[model samples]
Target chain A: MLTDSDSRNISIRAFRIDGRDNVATLLDPAAPGDRLKLLGDTELSAAPASPAGNEPCPEETPAPVLAALEPIPAGHKIALRDIESGEDIIKYGVVIGRAAAPIRRGHLVHIPLIRSLYDERSGHLDPETGKPKDISYE
Target chain B: MNNKTLSWPAYPRKDGRKGIRNILLIVYTVKCAEFVARKIAASFDCPDVQVTGFDGCTDNQYAVNLLISLIRHPNVGAVLTVGLGCEYVQAKWLSDIAAAEDKPSKSICIQDAGGTGASVREGISWCRGTLEFLSSAQTVPMTFSELVVGAECGGSDYTSGLAGNVVAGRFFDRLVDAGGTAIFEEIVEAIGLKSLLVQRAATPAAAAQLADVYDKMLDYCRSVGQYSISPGNFAGGLSTIEEKSMGAVIKSGSRPIQGVIKVSQKPPGKGLWLLDSTPDPHPVQFGITNPNDSEGLTALTSAGAHIVFLVTGRGSVVGSAVAPCIKITGNSSTFGRMSEDIDFNASEVLDGTCSMAQLTDRLVNVVIETASGKLTKAEKLGHFESWVPYKYQDTGSAGTRRCEGTE
Candidate 1:
């Protein structure tokens, strides 16, 4: 049973679709130092401490919380754990892309930082506009 | 599971099909007749009068079959076919098919009618009289069991999988449970999930069919060196085609897929169906499949969908010709920005203000309202965008006969 205060703190700011997922999706625009509560895959709620205070945690956690490392837009991915460079970025329990550089826990996971395995052009896109930088029809 | 009683007033057709709209469809046989057809439709200034047709002068069996299906669509009360006299796809042949279906139809050739002006004048006259005649057509009560709904997603973002498609999936489950039919297309979008798709087949035969379609689509993508993904999908936080596929397939719900039906082929005793618009395997691949969102919607409309759902996480402003498209977006901001074009906002589920079931119930209410003569935003705004591209697909024994040229 959750206390009223604990229940009040249970805001779903991000969602993890599968248990093996290394990334979660942000439901709202998040800024640095903002703590986001995770939803979905309740089995993974008991993993461990999420890179914060070292005090002994409660046995039954309301929801796992993570701190944002940067300004991430809504509907974007956030790393649930520290992902090494060239490692697979897992979401929906499947490999969506490979990390181009070492990504810290709670850091934003997106294009240029991550490259698609099938399409090499995924990494060669303009960061601001998300369009291919080298292609021209004319 | 709510067991809500769903029913609507429908324009009953001679073939025992029920329609939510009584439209006077204008068919242009070739590009030459397009201007006259548009003028005739615009002269009425009524949403019920709409234009759709093939632009090719050359013979393509696929295009002819698609046109025939549109003419026989239950929503179209009457049809008027316009041609440029020399086109292989004769307007008279199309009008004859419509007449055979017990619909009042007419055909006018631009060359035979003396010019574009004469053709437009005659088409407008026929439309005016047909609209008046269809106004008095009796409507009967239609139940949920009689409904066939199709779903397609476009301009997808991360919220599409988490919220938009999830709500649609839950609604599809409910609709299927209530004994209604549901269809979802874009097999090319279901990349890296062949086994999952095959596992959801309702029958062993359907499972085999799904496996074959999946393999063919994968090969087609490889041969063309292009998956169905786009830069907008990447901008929207989708990393790869696999991630997008995982999200796109959720709109099919958990219902066992009945079987794979070709484009323009109606579902054979449907609960849930997968429409394969991909070209048949050939030594040489020709046209692109589902080049745009409107093409996908038009394919679904040709498959006898009484109502179609267009789920857009980023937002879209398109509707189909025969079926009223209900646009839905899961991104609340996108919905806010495009509220006039988007119909339902599934972001309530993401905001924790409502559960998925609650959102699905609300979506069901929207569907029922749209089916009960409520004009969708697209219909109100007159956004009946349709596309009929020349594509090659094996038109199996699905009742669409090969065109043997106009008599």
Candidate 2:
């Protein structure tokens, strides 16, 4: 069984790769206590882990919490951190895109979903503050 | 420590070259004479007796030389030439060339051989006898190092660079390290990447040869009144010719190019070499040569490839006549859609589940297994196709030169 070392309530939903990867992509917007299976049919347990100082709210948080802890839908990517507008988006350990706005952990990352999420866009977004909402490239 | 011994079979040719396949070839000298050759081959009713095309006038040394080299290719057990009798490309020369190489060959000039009726009968006789000899041939054990691999990229996408082609490059590196040959062609698609490739030349002479190969392609592309990338490449999302070439060049890997060879020329040793493939755009005259990766692949295979490793991103279904093509795909979507067509999926690298080296190792094993008689998807589907050679522009003043370096 695989488990993340934080909140016990939320679990990993599904893993797209092996445990050796620095990051395992969420298959269905993972929660604090969901079971995840890696390739080759290996299974593991995972729980939600928080930033060093951030604590869980007294109220129960929804799975894949976004900006102000919003819930992102399936096939959507969430920010792993509070990404500032114009910062490079790294996926698969490569620079895939730059943030169009300040995005908080669990905030949704969606595009046309044609070729790649990062294929069309390039360059950094203008510097801004607060949990990033819909910021368009000018 | 001892290395594990491996086994392979060798079919020796009359010219002393070792082959991996015994083929009875019906070669069409011109487009006007294609139907005659095909009909004769079909009547012969042997899959191994296949039709290969080349339309060269007798005056064209390059075309004639290429034709002679192919007719006597190691894989070919025998040859039959077909022509209209009045064409500048003489059938008698082909017959003589094959006979000189000790191959059983016959030429049927439609006019002199008493037109279609007599020509078909005579050509059919040659095809039957050639097939018989080919069937009776024995196989001898050949080594891994003896195999030649052709690297071709068609129906490409961005993943081609990030996954399929790059992984193929790694495989080329390993093959070179192990003293095996890798051939990379479609020089038109390889232009902008030549600067990077010059670093991989094994010697100063080879480096100069590499430069010549680049210049010839650029010159041809310019002279041809068109750019190398077609509408297909543009639709595939390639912005510029250089961008497309950058992806194509990765298939050669990081191996030092030992020499530059023509379409008919084989590599001298176990190293990478760029094949000069800047051909005419007309498929009718040139017979589906340039912009047709399948034909370029077939040319490479006929040159003596035991297995052809095709890397695609957007996806292609074409295969070769002379060798088993192992298709490696880069896009997860493409692989998923055409899993039956693709042999290996390096797209696993994109998801970060597997490293490039890991995929390369797996691919090399695939090549080894394929060379040992594992039929590829195309082979099972009977997708054997032929291609035409690219014709380069002649510089009235700037002629051909010889290599000044040592062996």
Candidate 3:
């Protein structure tokens, strides 16, 4: 009895964490060629501090008309607007990661493409202990 | 925010503290005695009994202090300290601390007991008898303020940020509102935002302390050449440390931090406190900055956390030694997949069907039930895994190591 992601159920497709965030999180997986409804809210949050974030689309969002560029998974980020390289990728109204490359609207925001700027360390895990190796200022 | 009030039955500790779970906790002073200590606890076949220990074979004040913290936790009604007999972290000293505090305590060494078999026999006898005596202690009614709830998120995913941790955050806000202590850790999660936290400190001194801890945490991670995000975090949809942190930090709710304390220190008063939960990252030490779930739980328990709320997305099955861990998950798939392991499902919040308050009510009910001694998945499944830190920052610079990718 599990319902899948649809535009009307914006709750299932995407969630915006903060009004200032440029990305939205998908709650369920979707396929290519799927038309989606995205948030249009420029005011307050929809989910209001719930992990659902601000939501699939905000209150003013229109019905499903936007097409999926590719199949997307649940909990992954979807760029609502274009993100230029070196610019901050904002979520929760703060910078989470940075764009290592230019990201177009509707593209999936994830690792490799979007790099973590937390530190300069290479964050390699120790094969022997499964712990992370040390990074230095050098 | 219902005005619905409920009282919890609590076990009184001699130190003027209260405990939700009365435990006959067994400790191994060194790794060599771990097996013997484990055998003694398992041999008792009792859920009220548990085992954990430090791994250092040498004398480390940090290790000993951490051990003392766990031994003195309110949830631990009695204590049993074991050692290989020659280790620097003495079991005798720990036993004395317990006895001085008027707790029923015993100490043994395998090398002194003439080996593993004889030690196990004597240890089991002591554990059983201690459990019997502790059971007879008087009980009292407890409330939210009497509780110290530790918040942690492992196996984190985007759902964890959005719903799993969000639900826990709401719970923390409520707990604080009710005058209870709530803790949210993992400084690596706070990577890019030091001033933001500094602005929330209750006092100038605490603000300094908070900043220091954050700096130390960052340096520690840098010394070890690792960031806090794991491969699982990335694979599960979290891209960067800041991103993961934004999701993770919400679990503490929005409260002015009372103060900051080291991993072994206690929260000064109440409200929300920050635990410098990381092990000392001194360049000469052998342990890393990142602690697994068990280590974190034990540290919190040592700081007097009566219960732990573990919010996981990829779904972790870990339970701690001294305190009971309540599993709250925001992923429906994870919940359904590991139904037996998860305690509360906040997935509906993500689905837009269940409200955070509804999830809070469900979670609180389970916590009350757990406080009354209902077994958790980790307890039911004998998941008493533990980790004691060993490696710390090495001397000087080995070289410039780049922290690139999910290496």
Candidate 4:
């Protein structure tokens, strides 16, 4: 999962999909020139002219990054950002669905709905140490 | 194992097989004659009998294989296949398979009966007789080793590898220790672990057979131009096929891979196994087609499993027709999202709330109870989704040949 420092680790503009994705979609409306910070540390210069191949973000502009990405098609999951179709989808840092479609820099991905029965998270804190509680809900 | 005693009311069978329920089944040869199949089952209460779907094709070998396996399931006391007469799959073939097991079966075609109405009436009469025969069956005391348990993890997340699978693995180890059979399938996930698996073989021949099964699966996946690392596993935080495999393979517990089996073959002895599910990989958008966990469970049941221990991370609303699928959930969030579908939640292992041994013991008791006749979430909800075999375009032209130069 590690890479060389010379390789700039960019933040997903709303999300940068792969480290090597050609372009990133804009979550917020940006003027011709906007200074953006990268996620991982490798320095790179943004093109003066917005890179070509910018499609309209799935959602309206002026929204926060992750929020701005719109839902993709049903049963077809999209790349979180720009990613190759063969690459895995990393949500909550786990595999839920595979990338069924190629993602643009900012195109939203949709997760197929499988009927799940449980959704509760542990909130029990250890009374003695005040640490998060470990408990079996059912 | 001593802390608790699992119990349930089971139907004792003539072959010494134990069943949680006795069901008269109305099977169909094709989608075309589904109406006749339903009419046969509709004459009785749902509890007494139910209709299960399986389309028999003229040339789909896998479909024929599945139908034959399903018809002989211990849960099915008697069966009747409704054929449309002109279809490729013959009623006689199906009946012969069922009859070979000494199970009562009949086939009626709409064309032979003069029409759908007459066929339905004939089917209903046959089913009624089957139901009467099933009702006379009794419960027999079957030993633990008489059961062949199948393990599967789907809708997986991190906990799937960490806990859900581990729990199943523990059960698998215990099942083997107790002299029962256990099967772990979806061979694509067993990649990279072959060395470790081969090490578990009881004999050299078994080890070589295990390696061959892995080779076939590896070859099949490479030929289809499909990556063995499912996009779902990658999205779920698994990095490589190996990482996904490490998690997926844990479901077999630490039992030896006794003998490799094909989708249609039953496990011949007690121990671990890898079933070849490498028929064909469906495209990512649609996900690969697999037998409903229940259908696979039924195959294991026909192979002689009395019950199944199912584990899930993503969670599914699923149940089996013959063996009860006692689902254990692994993902903390998903366990919360689908509590109803889950019978046991091992998500605590992720948070360190519960030790692995503690969860394993809990799961073992659940299996015992399920075998004794407890209804699983899927069984209760009536989720009977089964899949047909995957079909390739050319049915094995040179295009489907295994690649030469890849691992």
Poorest 10 consecutive residues by lDDT, candidate 1 chain B? B398-407
lDDT values, one for every candidate: 0.82, 0.61, 0.73, 0.57
Residue lDDT tens for model 1, B202-269: 89888878877877777677768788888777776777777788788879887888988887888889
Per-residue lDDT tens digits for candidate 2, residues B285-307, read 44334757776786576556667
Per-model TM-score of chain A alone?
Answer: 0.73, 0.42, 0.60, 0.27
Fnat computed for model 3: 0.48
Model 1 over residues A1-138: C-alpha lDDT tens digits?
434455356453887765667888988778897778777634322322121123323232223457788998777888988889999776655556789999999899887888866666767876546788788857
Best model per lDDT: 1
Best by TM-score: 1
TM-score versus the correct structure, for each prediction: 0.88, 0.69, 0.85, 0.67
Name the better of 1 and 4 by DockQ: 1
Instruction: Please list the residue runs of candidate 3 whose C-alpha ends up more than 4 Å from where it truly belongs after superposition.
Output: A1-12, A37-66, A84-86, A100-102, A111-113, A120-138, B1-5, B279-281, B287-291, B391-407
Per-residue CA lDDT of model 4 for A50-70, tens digit only, reads 111233222212212232244
| lDDT of candidate 3 over A1-138, digit per residue (tens) | 213444455333677756667788877676765555443223225333322222333322322345457777866787777789888787866667788888877778776557766654323433222234563435
> Ranking under TM-score, best-scoring first?
1, 3, 2, 4
The TM-score measured for candidate 3 stands at 0.85
Error of 1 at B8 (Å): 1.7
- Give the C-alpha lDDT of model 3: 0.73
CAPRI grade of model 4: incorrect
